[model samples]
Target: MEEMAIVFSPKYYEHNTGRDHPESSRRLKTVMRELKRLNLFSATTGCQLVEPELASIENLELVHDPEYVGLVKRICELGGGLLDLGDTVVSPKSFEVARYAVGGARKAVDSVLDGNYQKAFALVRPPGHHAGPYYGAGFCVFNNVAVAAAYLIEQHSFERVLILDVDAHHGNGTQEIFYDSEKALYMSLHEDPREFPGTGFVDEVGEGAGLGYNVNVPLPFGTGDEEYMKAFDEVVVPVARQYEPQFVLVSVGYDSHYGDPVGKLQLSAAAYESIFKKTLDLASTVCQGRLVAVLEGGYNLGQLGKLAALTISRMADFSYSMKDGTPPANSNVARRARRVIEKVEKAHSAFWKLRA
Candidate 1:
């Protein structure tokens, strides 16, 4: 009955990632602040506030390996040492909160797929993407979006799906999970390999049967609206049209916004609005308005909040506008990224029906 459902739980704070970690509970706190400041909190109407359900191992095994899932459970159960080399730490309650994260995503997917909502956003933390089918990285515990996407495919009987990631860091896990399937297309536009976790290269473009289906647009540092749009126009839109998925999901991370300390690009609220609007256009064309966005990394709360509100407003199809004044364009990255994307366009044109 709600237009949108935003899922969150205070229990996500239990992960206890230790001091000075960028991917802390503080990030979600800021997102919560922004949502409240924008008045998305009223559970009475408009947006729905739903309790997060724990994602069963069955759902998790959709994107993660059974052995890896077992290991994570064992580590959380044993809970005396770090579950990861670093960035990801576990406590006695970690499995609960981590499950909440994945469960929240599933709930969102279910709500959307079941006709309970037009669209939904999962604001749970311990971001996924750096997580892989068998591993975790970049503060992610489990591939939350991956599990939920797989759920949509298996439980909902969907034929085609699109995973769009705008995270500053690449969505390595989502990419790995959906890499070889034409039924699922994973696309990411992120900072170059110069950044950490270092994947998302122009050439990664999925392997084997997924060849050319996986699109990675790696932008350089200081990329602004112009560059972002260029990537969208040249790569994202063109390839996506060919695939024409039944459902669309975005890995929405705010770190690419200007002044995110950990970020390399200089995207602003306006750029985000543009991207969201473009996504809306595509969703309207392909998925019958069935789209979902999950929270990824965005450490700067202020920027994140503005972008979040702007994103929701656009998703709700309100008249879109934003604050102005962007720095000069990073045309160099734009041009270089285009060359790579053009190759993708050529390689995958048969599947996606690229413009000649």
Candidate 2:
């Protein structure tokens, strides 16, 4: 077994939305091609490729409504149509492919927990962060990360799980699912929700026992790597250190890259490497290096492959960098980011030590 595992399946492509859809089969294909170009597929690469199983309906129900689960299947069976108002589309095999995506995430989690790999990345998609218990939106079918986290808490007896969503869009489904559960801590650094799915605000901290556990750092458009790293240093790193979770899961999305077609942020490919390095270090310190990352969104086919390969290289402890030098910081976004940090600190100080 390799030190890092990659869970994937070609079945993921069967969920075809359309040629023009940003979330197309070509995303995974590009990623796979780059991994090959980077020689990441060689037998000596120290990475293992694992196929994903189909997630059980029982497992799906852990984070989705049973009725909703049936509805997805029923809709697909009836020759598949739009899953929601528009963002999510379903083909005949989409239901099965989505289940496999969820299963891929679980496999990654299980691999880390079983000590077979220090970390794993699920390269499957139909990104789940936007899918909620009652509805699927933003190209998501089921809340894949949520299902994996709930599995850890309910089945494996793991108490503390930290979900770090670095997607361009807020993980609205993830936040809503764990909004009241202290067992899971949901943190997201997303494009301001005013853009889409519109929910991850500074004040939308968790409720009930989960109060202060949910953190959102909503950045304005044109925010670049520096601003994102600042948020990580001030908020993500500190909070992860304080939380000291038993396991860490990253909702990796490269859509924030400047080259992405759908997103408006200005992150460069290097931003992902920087973020992964920090997250990997955090996992080492707080969770014995047990970590798993799931693919969320990154529309630019050209950048996705390289960025995904770079992320896998980081997970495997290899050195690599993308030459797409990140653009200079947006000073205006920087000022606003500081304010957001202060607001988050005040909201969360009641629960965590904000300063060293």
Candidate 3:
């Protein structure tokens, strides 16, 4: 088996969101270029680049409403229009491309579960996580990660799956999709809703049978490596250990980086490395490294490729590094993050045993 599998396709670039939109083909272009420049596909790296098939309507209906699926297709068929009132642009080819993106995510999961690779990363586009059951928002046309998680439970008969979302923004759509399913535990660390916007508050835990299965850590603005690592050590790690999922999925988003123009948080490159390392270690311990990471968000064109390449290199166990200059040290942000962490721990105290 290879060390890692990367699911990608040149077709991902066919979904055009306009030249000035933050969610553009340029992001993947840069990432693929960087991956090549760093020789990540060399024989020494033990990484394979795999193309993905288009996700069938049956696969989409696993999580989304069938009517919504048809609606998207019809819209794209009529040329191009916005899926949501804001930002989410779609061209004539977008519906096909979006299906391909979901297919890429599912392919990653299959690659890992089939023992073809120890781990996999689906580097697809039109970033999901913000798209919900019937609506698409936040430059997202479909909820890729959610569909993959649902696919695991419905198609593979998996009982326990964990989705760790490290996007700077909360995965509201993902949380919504699995909000009442105990089989999928959704955890997210994002900038405070007050700073950004949308859901992911501390009290919005799961409901019904899925109660306490949803976890959110809304850090303060300017939150950096120290705060993120602390939350990972204290909250994310403990909850995940108790959940003991059969597989792990990460909604990996680099928008939290300080260099990202679209994201407001202050995370550095080292912080991202630590985040990936912790997730890998957790997966290794609980699920025998059955992990697949799907790209979500990150808008800084200049740094997007470098960060993505670094992540892939790390997955391949190859040495590649990029520094984010000096890490930010803000005592105020630290204090706020501590409060948020405390609140999250307290909120979920009844669900899992947390470290004091």
Candidate 2 residue-pair clash tally = 0
Which of 1 and 3 is ahead in lDDT? 3
List the global CA lDDT of all models.
0.79, 0.89, 0.90
Residue-level lDDT of model 2, residues 156-214, one tens digit each, is 99889999999999999999999999899999998889868889998998999999889
lDDT per residue as tens, model 3, 1-356? 24899999999999998879999999999999988987777788889898887999999898899899999999999998999877789999999999999999999999998898999999999889999899888889889999899999999999999999998999989999999989999999999876444799999999999999999999887898888889999999999999999999999999999988887688889888888888888988999989999999999989999888778766777888997684658998899999999999999999999854
In what order do the candidates fall by TM-score, top score first?
A: 3, 2, 1
TM-score of each: 0.92, 0.97, 0.98
Displacement of residue 200 (Cα, Å) in model 3 is 0.2
lDDT of 1: 0.79
The list of candidate 2 runs beyond 4 A from truth reads none
Positional deviation of residue 147's Cα in model 2 after best superposition, in angstroms: 0.6
